[model samples]
Target: MIKLTLLLLFFIIFIKKNICWSDEPHMIVSAIAYYNLNDKEKRILNKIFLNYKEDRDFNDPITGALWADHIKSNEHSTVNPSDIRRYEILDIFNEWHFVQIPYNPTKMFLPHYYLNAHKGKYNAMGVLKYIYKILIQVQKKPRHGTYFSYNFYLRFFIHIFADIHQPLHTISFYNEHFPNGDKGGSDITLNYHGQIGKLHHLCDNIFYSRKKHWPHINPSILQKEAHVLMNMYPPEHFGSKLTIPSNKIDFIDSIANESHQLAIEHIYSHIPVRLVNKDMQIKVDQHFVINLKGILNKQMVLAGYRLSLYLKDIIANIPEDL
Candidate 1:
């Protein structure tokens, strides 16, 4: 029984890596965004994020970044559970991590690909917009504000904002071979040297430094990496796109689209269509790995910069009394 339990635990950790950006990048993005806030905004967030049900897990900005991901259950999932159940008190869902915009080759990368028809509003793009609206309304009417709800969605917004910036999270591969879509590269296996994993896992863990047991990893190392990424790819690196859209929906959609484009240019362009199946796996060479890391690093920095702006807007609007 003990051996079986330990095996189950290891399996969960292994599979979890394929699902979303590993904890290191998620926390690092939040750390970058956190420092971008002014003194007052920081103070407000520090207080607001102090406790969720008195759980100290989300009290600090960097540590708290993983809250949204943590709430999602390994078994049942919390995002949009059809039936109201005892365990799912939160709206956190495994689905909220990615928006599937199909990358169909026959279609010649048409504009229709960007439409939200795939998963409707259940995806990261739609949910982020929904939560932003709620947070805005809650700030306007602090008298009717639910503190827990506010904190809950705020954490989700922060996490999801960074999520959509990840290329694989915004788009999936769909060709004649995969009529159903690749589930954001999760279905497509890749062999990099001797390491074998899904394409999604490779993209999610491109940072690949001190990944295991990440929750207890040194906080300073995360902070230092965040600073290094920011210095490496400053806001000036991305012109005009960094401008937050006045329309919240447009902002969310725009970032999702940006990540989708990245999926096309960086991810899919490299792999041949013939080798997209389980039988014949995609063989990754050293050059591809190096270039992928560079692109992913840029994505991380971009996520952090854009997230900082979004956080500033959210923090600025919360009612002083709330």
Candidate 2:
């Protein structure tokens, strides 16, 4: 009964759009990652997820990829009241989704107020490193206990891998106009197709869709999109970018820096600067939209490939008994 209720709640909430890549793109990323695995790797993944097949929250990688985001919903608080401590921990670390890496192209002087607001805080990069270690430990020793289950860590691993790939999530721009920062472009208002919207939200909904299939995803749509993306941008398409770093920490930092650099060169450079502080909005044009979509598309593909490669390594390290 509880699972049914949560499923209904997810459908209702997902009907509206989300602020980051929406659920569709996340699902597509998971699907792409799964499809990238070999036959044996797929079987191992299936075995690991067998315990969660019936659970609405993480029945599959596609659903699991959205678990991190779904927890933000009010309904999630009531799903498992028995785990108060766990819920509390999650609430405290709820802001782990993004890391505010500063970006100042002109190096204009500004107050030190917003520069290090997120410094020393637990961000996506930190969470990912911690979770990756937990995963390896759990696989090495089946009895390696944790505050959260292996599935919990696995789902978060999948979700954060995709989240950090978003350019806006890894960077925030600072300048003279808005001395502080734009809160990862959330404060930048723009006229998108005659509608006033935040720049961050617009970027988040790059692959936006209003199709509502309650309590379940349209598998055809998900698989087709994933397949198309893999074909369109294969691993070789990324060239040297596909080569991951040797150290895990370096690997995570590389991902964050890649997205941050892309935001500076591609995103901030193309968009018009908002001069007026009043009702003026940056009018979005086709050229800008096209360019933004292209960058986002490649990011999504690269994230999926990286996710698949990481999972493959994890599975290889796991003991057969696990």
Candidate 3:
């Protein structure tokens, strides 16, 4: 009975969360981490990455991170059918990029079970760990599947790590008004600068436009930006919450929880609560932009730094014999 109620409730509030940051934001993350990788690590990644590279310009962390997103093409929609990556044709695996932790996950029964049970399939945290299992299989043998080889999974490794850091991606608020959760914030609308838009869309909007290409910033600038923020909020800033990681899974969950905490304390707190209707129209105060910028900049930097460490750990450990 409880499971049925929760499932029914979920469908009622199911709004797809926008990609927390756009393609360029994801690119920024990979690019920063790529800067920190050693020459040998770069060489290894370079070799594996060659499988997906089409143009000579495809050899950078930004490009590599963008690789996962580039699979999506309106090419097929154009006058001439454009070349689509083989994998995109198979499955986008969109749901693997995030998990909507309820306002109070500990208090919810079915939601908690669904989270643990469907981590790999339905949650970004599970898929992040699942990459390791796939890597182990790749190291042992090849041709397990034609399309999804080690390189293919590497694309997800680059993308999903960055995805989890976006606060909206990691959480949703549930309450009397939103019995099924706030649909990861998409179900709520805010009025900003005379325009009304979904709150999640606004949080995820990093660049000025929606064009598929990256922002016009240089890679060096992004790396420096990422470097600066990583130092600003080091491990010391994180409380016992981040310090007590018992295993690999725990570490990722810790990060997710961190993201959730921010969604509540930093992101959602600014909005006037009574003003938040099913699709509330809100005008943010002048300080809201300042706070949002600070939050986003910090998350992006941490995303890059942690992504680098995690990716390096996996790539560095892949057996030489394989």
Strongest candidate by TM-score = 1
Score residue 95 of candidate 2 by CA lDDT.
63
lDDT per prediction? 0.72, 0.69, 0.62
Score residue 204 of candidate 3 by CA lDDT: 67
lDDT of 2 by residue, 39-117 (tens): 9988766666666643445556676787776666444332353543133233555668888788876677755745664
lDDT ranking, high to low:
1, 2, 3
Give residue 57's error in model 1 in angstroms: 1.6
Taking the tens digit of each residue's C-alpha lDDT, what string does model 1 give over 90-173?
Answer: 444877888888777765333554544545778898889887776666555556555587687878888888888889998877
TM-score for all models, in order of appearance: 0.84, 0.80, 0.73
Which pairs of residues collide in model 3? 191-282
Error of 2 at 154 (Å): 1.1
As for lDDT, the candidate ahead, 1 or 3, is: 1
Q: Residue 38's C-alpha lDDT in candidate 3?
A: 90
Error of 2 at 150 (Å): 1.1
Superposition error at 17 for model 3 (Å):
9.2
Runs of candidate 3 exceeding 4 Å displacement: 1-17, 53-60, 72-92, 104-120, 136-148, 207-212, 215-246, 272-275
- Model 3 Cα lDDT, one tens digit per residue, 1-322: 9756634432322122354466657776786677668988887777666655453334454666765554553333222323433334423566676787766433443455534533545578888778755664455343343322556677777788887888888876655566566767777876544545677765665412221345345666666665665678664564453343435546887788888888889767776554465856766643665577577766776777677676666675555543
Name the top lDDT candidate.
1
